[model samples]
Target: MKKILLACSAGMSTSLLVAKMKEAAEKRGTEVEIWAVAQDKAPSEMKKADVLLIGPQMRFMKKKFAVVAEEVGIPLDVIDPVAYGRIDGEAVLNKAIELIGE
Candidate 1:
């Protein structure tokens, strides 16, 4: 299963998005592990994830995370603001799968 980790200010905001992503994954019959963590916890969590997606609000932290992501050898990107605002799980899930090259 692919692991997708989303990081935000406090992690709470992305909980719904994670749930939505899981639902999307279920619909697609894709085996995936999706979760959210506070930005402070992201580095450690990224070690266990196949990909790291930052919340749009935390987009500035991408540069900080890029180093660790590169060291961990995983794709990292900020969640699209438009999709995130709408909580479009399918779109986010598709982006994650594409990043994973699955």
Candidate 2:
């Protein structure tokens, strides 16, 4: 199974996106686990994920996250603001798969 993680400011904001992403995975018959975490907890959560996506609002920390992600061999990206604002789970899911070369 592929493990995908999403991080936002307080974690709560991404809850809806997480649900949508899960549904998209189910429909596609993809073996994936998706979860959202607060930015502060991201580093610890990274070890368990195959890919990590940060909310657009947290884009500033991408540089910092990129360094940590590189050390652990996981791809990281800032979610598109337009998709995020509209809660485009499929787009995010596709992005995650692309990032991990799925």
Candidate 3:
């Protein structure tokens, strides 16, 4: 199973998106593990994830997030604002696959 870690300012906003992504994965028969957490807690969460996706508000921290992900050989990226706000699960899942070379 693939693991995706979502990070936001306080982990509140992305929590909703997490549910949508999960449903999308389920409906599409994609075996993925998704979770949302505050940006500050990302380091601990990263250990368990195969990829790290950040929300629009947290895009500025992409460099920092990338650094951590690289250290552990995990891919990292910022989610598309359009897909994120609209909760476009298919697009988000596609993006994750692209980022991770799936």
Candidate 4:
């Protein structure tokens, strides 16, 4: 199963998106492990993730996350604000697949 980590300011708002993404993955018959974490905790969490997704609120952290992702040999991306605000699971799931080349 692919591992994905969602990073946000407090890890609260992204929890809902996490559920939506998981549901979308299930509907698409894809097996993945998804979790949400605070931005401050991302570095440690990245140790176990295959992909790192940052919420728009954490856009400033993208470069830092990219560096970490590169060092870990994983893909990193920022979620689309539209898809994120609307909790569009399908789009988010697609983004994940695209990032990991799955």
Each model's Cα RMSD: 0.5, 0.6, 1.0, 0.8
Local accuracy of candidate 2 as per-residue lDDT tens digits, 27-84: 9899899999999999889989999999999999999899889989999999999999
| Most accurate candidate by lDDT | 1
TM-score of each: 0.98, 0.98, 0.94, 0.96
Instruction: Judging by TM-score against the true structure, name the best candidate.
Output: 1
Q: Of the candidates numbered 1 and 2, which has the greater lDDT value?
A: 1
Which residue pairs in candidate 3 collide? Answer: none
* lDDT, residue 70, candidate 3: 85
Q: Which ten residues in a row have the lowest lDDT in candidate 4?
A: 89-98
Give residue 60's lDDT in candidate 2 (0 to 100).
97
Better of 2 and 3 by TM-score: 2
Clashing pairs in 2: none
For residues 43-101, write the lDDT of model 3, one tens digit per residue: 88998988899999989999988888988889888999999989887788888877778
1-102: candidate 4 lDDT, tens digit per residue? 989899999999999999999999999899999999999999889989988899998999999888888888899989999999999977988898889897
C-alpha lDDT score of every prediction, in listed order: 0.96, 0.95, 0.88, 0.91
> Which lDDT value does model 1 have at 94?
92
Q: Candidate 2: where are CA atoms >4 Å away?
A: none
C-alpha lDDT (0 to 100) for residue 22 of candidate 2? 91
Candidate 1, residues 7-100, lDDT tens digits: the string is 9999999999999999999988999999999999999999999999999999899999999999999999999999999999999999998998
